[model samples]
Target: MSEPLPWYKHFWPWFIVVLLLGVIIKSLVALNIAIDNADSLVSDDYYKEGKAINMDLRKIKQAKNLGMQFLVKVEEHQLIITQHGGPQYKAALQVSFIHPTLEDKDFNVNATADGTGAYRIALSNAITGPWNVRLEGFDNSWRIQQRVVINDDVEYWLN
Candidate 1:
C-alpha cells in the first residue's frame, strides 16, 4: 500500500485553494474601488429642488406664451444667439452654462442683442461635454432651458 500525499503537496487541493484565494483578492479589489468612487449625482437639497419644480414649470409656460424661439450656435470661440418671434426688449439676456456634476465649472454671461435680434458673446475657452443651458430675459419674465451634449461645433434651437 502507498502512503497518502500531504495536503500541501497535493496538486488538486492547492489548485482549489489558489482559485478561492484569487476570487477573494478580486472581490477585495472591487470593494476598494467601489468605496473610493462614491457617487455624487444626488443633490443635498433634493427636497427643495423638488418643491421648486412648479416655479420652473411656470417660467417655461411664460416663455411658451410669449412665443419665444432661439437659435444658439458657436462660431470661432464666440456664442451667437438669434431670437425669433419674441417680444422686443432692450435688455441684456442672461445665459448660463451649468455643468451637470460640477458646480465650480458653471459659468454665466450677459449677451446684449445687436440692433437686430442677434446676440453675441466671446468665449475665452472652449466648452465641451454635457451642459444645461439656461437663457432668461433680462426682466426674468421668460426663461428657456435645454440639455446639450457638445461634442463638436453644433447648433441648438429652442422654442
Candidate 2:
C-alpha cells in the first residue's frame, strides 16, 4: 500500500459516480428524443381521418335494401340509385366514383328519378380496376355518406 486515500484526494470514487450519472443522463435524453420523433411522424387529424374511412367501409358492406346490383358496364355503367323512405325528396342525390390508381380523376353522375324516390345514373368508361362507391344523402340536419369498395375479385353479400 503506497498511501491511504484522503477526503479530497480520492479520485476513483468520484470518477465512478460521474460515470454512472453520465450513463443515466444519456439514456434519458435518448428516450425523450425517440418519443418526440414518433409524434412528428404522423398528425392527429390524419389519424382520425383514416379511422373515418374504416368506419365507412364497414357500414357500406352491412347496408340492406338499396337497389338492384347491375353490371357497371364501361360503355354504359348504369347506377340505379333508389331512395327508400317516406314522402317525396326535394334534394338531388349525388353519385361519385373514385379510382384506386388515379385518385384525382373524379366522375360525377346525376341521378335520374324514376317515381317513388327512385333514381338512376349512367357513367361511361369511368375506371377499370377496383373502386370505392360513395353514397351521400341528407336527413334533416344530419349528412349521411356511405362508402363501398367494388373489386373484381372480392364478393360481398349480406349473410
lDDT of 2: 0.52
- RMSD (CA, angstroms), candidate 1: 3.8
Instruction: Tell me the tens digit of each residue's lDDT in model 2 across 1-159.
Output: 688768667888889989999999999999999886664334569978899777765544433333323223233354555444423354665556766455456676655567655566655643445565554433322123423455433432211
Per-prediction CA RMSD (Å): 3.8, 10.9
- Using lDDT as the measure, the top candidate is 1
| Shift in Å, residue 70, candidate 2 | 12
Give the Å error, residue 4, model 1.
Answer: 28
- Candidate 1 structure quality by residue, lDDT tens digits, 1-159: 999988899799989999999999999999999998777676799989988887888888999998888888876588888886667656899999999988778899988988876888888878888999999888887889989886546888877
What 10-residue stretch in candidate 2 is worst by lDDT?
Answer: 67-76
Candidate 1 weakest ten by summed lDDT: 82-91
Q: State TM-scores per candidate.
A: 0.68, 0.38
